[model samples]
Target: MDVQEAVFLALDLTGTFVFAVSGVLLAARRGFDITGGLVLGLMTGIGGGMIRDVLLDRVPNALGQPIYLAPPLIATLLIYLIGKHVSRARIWIVTFDAIGLAIFSVTGTTIALGAEANYPAALLMGALTACGGGLMRDAVASEDPAIFIGTDLYLIPALFGAGLTILAEVTGLLGGVVSLVIAAAAFGFRMLAWKLQWRVPQPMRQWSYRETGRRMKKLPSVFRKPD
Candidate 1:
């Protein structure tokens, strides 16, 4: 592989390892056994890329090349062996997850652009590739996925990085340094959001049984007309 390609691959693997660590840590925190931790780690490391590949109508790199599986496996085993000694597991999980999110955002957008996808499609792919893994991990663990629940500004940082990557690529400014800067910016933004507890706005009107009942009471009056 060329040097540029090699660098991206290295970044991708780094992201995979960090994401795996996040998932394994989460499993440990939730009282899962080693087997469960391994399963969750693998899902969180590779599920996003698999989803991206499927969307792009290509074979998943993780499945097509066995080497793609190594980082997650290593991470799972390492965490399983030393989990008891790890303090501040939650903080570590969030930090690692943010790193993975940032790296994957860049790599995914690059891959989509290479596939000849348009800008919007590339952006969507990038966000998905960063997020799908964590969603899968949460699903397996039976927890509400953080991205959808408005727990923090998760997807926004991914999008911000992806957007910057796209801008750089289109402007012919994309390089190792640029990519690293974009990823770092994204990571910083995510961490900032976490520290601030920033959240996406909820629906202006929340629907609930009580609201529905109140509306129903008004509904009959509208049907009765001019009594």
Candidate 2:
């Protein structure tokens, strides 16, 4: 493989391990069995990339290559071995997840642009790749994914990372050193957001009386017209 391909593979492996650890921790919190934990871990590691590949019209590397699956399996085993002895599994999981998000955001943006996608589509792909695994994990665990809830700056870092990659590509600076710097900046922003408890405001809508009445009227259509 060429240098770029090698770098891509390395990033994929690192992201997979990070995501897998996050999933394993969630599984432990939910009291899942060992098999369930492994399944969840594997899903978390490969889920985002699978989505990105499907969108980009390519076969997911995670399925075609053993290297992609092996890291998560190893991570699952490690988490299992450590079990509860790890004093700060949650903190470590969050840290790794942020790093993975940063890496995958850049990777997704680069891949999308390499496939000749438009800037907007490439940015969307990066956001999806960065946040998709966490969304799936939250869904499986019966929790709302933070990305959708505006609970944190989860999507912001991904956007920044993708933007940087896109800018670099446009400026003819899509080199390894530039990409690494962009990824580091993205990860640093994420860490800062976490440390500062940065959150987007969730606006609550006030229901109009007319709107409430319309909803009330519609609700009785299948209940004998409410007598």
Candidate 3:
């Protein structure tokens, strides 16, 4: 494959694998059956690309590449087999999701640029690609999507990564290594956000509508690291 093609393939497959891993783990944790796990994995693996492709007026890659479907199925089986035995499976799920977010964001940005989108549009695409699958999965699983609710610093890291990649391209520094590094930096940024508890900026005004303390405790725990 040409260099650009090779880079795209690597990032695409890696992101698919990681996202599938997270989806399967979460499905299993939520008491889903094997079929549910597989279905969830498939959706979480390709939902973002589906959105990206539709917006770009292209056929979604998930429909064309049967081989690309393998990762989610494999991930589902593996996580189902071994994930139940682990005490800290939640950590693994989140870690994989974070990695998936970082890689997919860059791939989405690059793909949008290929379609002649401006930098801002490309950055938004990147963030969408990073969060789209998870949002879909959350909706299906009946959990609130943390990205929109500001449960973590998810969207910022994605946009920053996409913006950095575009900046590199503008400065004539784009390459496979640079892309990979930027992706890693995005991952680190996410980890740091989790560590430091960085929150999305909200309006300074307090807007408490009711006594949410009792109701908040009843919400599902599927949000985060695994968001």
Candidate 4:
């Protein structure tokens, strides 16, 4: 592979490795056994890429390259061995996960673009590659997926990274540096959200029962209305 391809492959593998580590750590925190950690880690590491490949009508990279499976298993083994001493594993889950997510966003978008996908499809594949694995991991673990179930900055930053990749690819400018910047920005955004405990706004009014009752009192009761 040329330098660009080599660089992207390294980034993709790094993402897989870190995502596996995050999954294993989370499994440890959830009281899962080593085997469970292994399962979750493997799922989290390669699930997104597999899903993206299938959606794109291509062979899953992990399937063809069995070596890709090693990272998650190795990560699980490491976490199981030293998880107790690493009291900060729980907190580090977010950090590792964020980094993995950012890298996956860039890698996925790059792959999709290389496959001749349009910008929109490339953007979507980027998100899938960043999130599909986590979704699978959470479902297997019987927990909520952090990206969609909460106001976490995960999906937003991933989308931004994907969008940036598309823009750079289209313009043929900063093609090499774009992925790096996108990954870094995405990581920073995710870390800041976690640090600030930021949340996405929803349609929730957040009125307490007392407030609801007060508001109700202002309206005429049906009993007092003409029957």
What's each prediction's clash count? 0, 0, 0, 0
For model 3, residues 1-227, the per-residue Cα lDDT tens digits are 89878887878888998998888888888899999999889888999989998998887778877777988989988987788686786787778888999999888888898899988888888888888998888789887775866657888888888899899889998778888999999999988887788877564332342334433334356665554
- The C-alpha stretches of model 3 lying farther than 4 A from their native spots are 203-227
Per-residue lDDT tens digits of candidate 4, residues 50-142? Answer: 999988888888998887898898898888888889888757888888988999999998888888888899999999999888888888888
Q: Which residue pairs collide, candidate 2?
A: none
**Which 10 consecutive positions of candidate 4 have the poorest summed lDDT?**
202-211
Candidate 1 lDDT tens digits, 119-171: 99999999999998998998888877879867588899999999999999989
List, residue by residue over 141-182, the lDDT tens digit for candidate 2.
897786876657899999999999999999999877787888
Q: lDDT, candidate 2, residue 151?
A: 53
Ranking by TM-score: 1, 4, 3, 2
TM-score of each: 0.89, 0.86, 0.87, 0.87
| Candidate 2 error regions (>4 Å) | 206-227
Please list the C-alpha lDDT of all candidates, in the order they appear: 0.90, 0.83, 0.84, 0.85
* Clash pairs for candidate 4: none
